[model samples]
Target: MDVQEAVFLALDLTGTFVFAVSGVLLAARRGFDITGGLVLGLMTGIGGGMIRDVLLDRVPNALGQPIYLAPPLIATLLIYLIGKHVSRARIWIVTFDAIGLAIFSVTGTTIALGAEANYPAALLMGALTACGGGLMRDAVASEDPAIFIGTDLYLIPALFGAGLTILAEVTGLLGGVVSLVIAAAAFGFRMLAWKLQWRVPQPMRQWSYRETGRRMKKLPSVFRKPD
Candidate 1:
């Protein structure tokens, strides 16, 4: 494959694998059956690309590449087999999701640029690609999507990564290594956000509508690291 093609393939497959891993783990944790796990994995693996492709007026890659479907199925089986035995499976799920977010964001940005989108549009695409699958999965699983609710610093890291990649391209520094590094930096940024508890900026005004303390405790725990 040409260099650009090779880079795209690597990032695409890696992101698919990681996202599938997270989806399967979460499905299993939520008491889903094997079929549910597989279905969830498939959706979480390709939902973002589906959105990206539709917006770009292209056929979604998930429909064309049967081989690309393998990762989610494999991930589902593996996580189902071994994930139940682990005490800290939640950590693994989140870690994989974070990695998936970082890689997919860059791939989405690059793909949008290929379609002649401006930098801002490309950055938004990147963030969408990073969060789209998870949002879909959350909706299906009946959990609130943390990205929109500001449960973590998810969207910022994605946009920053996409913006950095575009900046590199503008400065004539784009390459496979640079892309990979930027992706890693995005991952680190996410980890740091989790560590430091960085929150999305909200309006300074307090807007408490009711006594949410009792109701908040009843919400599902599927949000985060695994968001």
Candidate 2:
């Protein structure tokens, strides 16, 4: 493989490994058995890519090439062996998950672009590649998906990385250095959001007749009802 291809492969595998670690850690935190951990880890490692590949009408790398499965298996084994000594499993899970998020955001976009997808599709694919696995992991573990929770930044950073990748590719500025920068930017954004406890804005209250009335009263007389 060419240097660029090799780099992307490394980043992809790294993402898979980190995602697997996060999944296994979540299983451990939930007091799941080894079998549960293994399944969760594999889900988190390959689920997103599988989703992307299927959507793009290609066979999943993990399915077509058995080697793509190695990272998660190794990650599961390592965590099972050493997980008992690690405290704060949740923290590690979030951290490694962030790393995977960054990597997948970029690599996924690249894959979509390589597949000749348009810009919008590439952007969405990047996010799916970064988040599909986590969504599945949470569903399997019976936890709320962090992407939907909006407790801290999640989807935004993935989009940011994906957008940046698209911009770089379009501008002919994409390179190994640029790719790394994009991933770093994504990772930093996620970490900062976590550190600051940033959250996506939610509706202040459920929409209802009372809320409608209150809003109506706040409007200017011209815009309010004659009554």
Which predicted model would earn the best lDDT? 2
Candidate-wise lDDT, in order: 0.84, 0.92
Per-residue lDDT tens digits for candidate 1, residues 1-227, read: 89878887878888998998888888888899999999889888999989998998887778877777988989988987788686786787778888999999888888898899988888888888888998888789887775866657888888888899899889998778888999999999988887788877564332342334433334356665554
Query: In model 1, which runs have C-alpha deviations exceeding 4 angstroms?
Result: 203-227
| TM-score (C-alpha) between model 1 and the true structure | 0.87
lDDT of candidate 2 over 1-227, digit per residue (tens): 89988888888999999999999999999999888999999999999999999999998989887877999889889998999998988889999999999999999999999999999999999999999999999999999888986667889999999999999999999878899999999999998998898888664554454566655445457767787
Off by over 4 Å in 2: 204-227
Candidate 1, residue 171: the lDDT equals 95
lDDT of 1: 0.84
Candidate 1 — which pairs collide? Answer: none
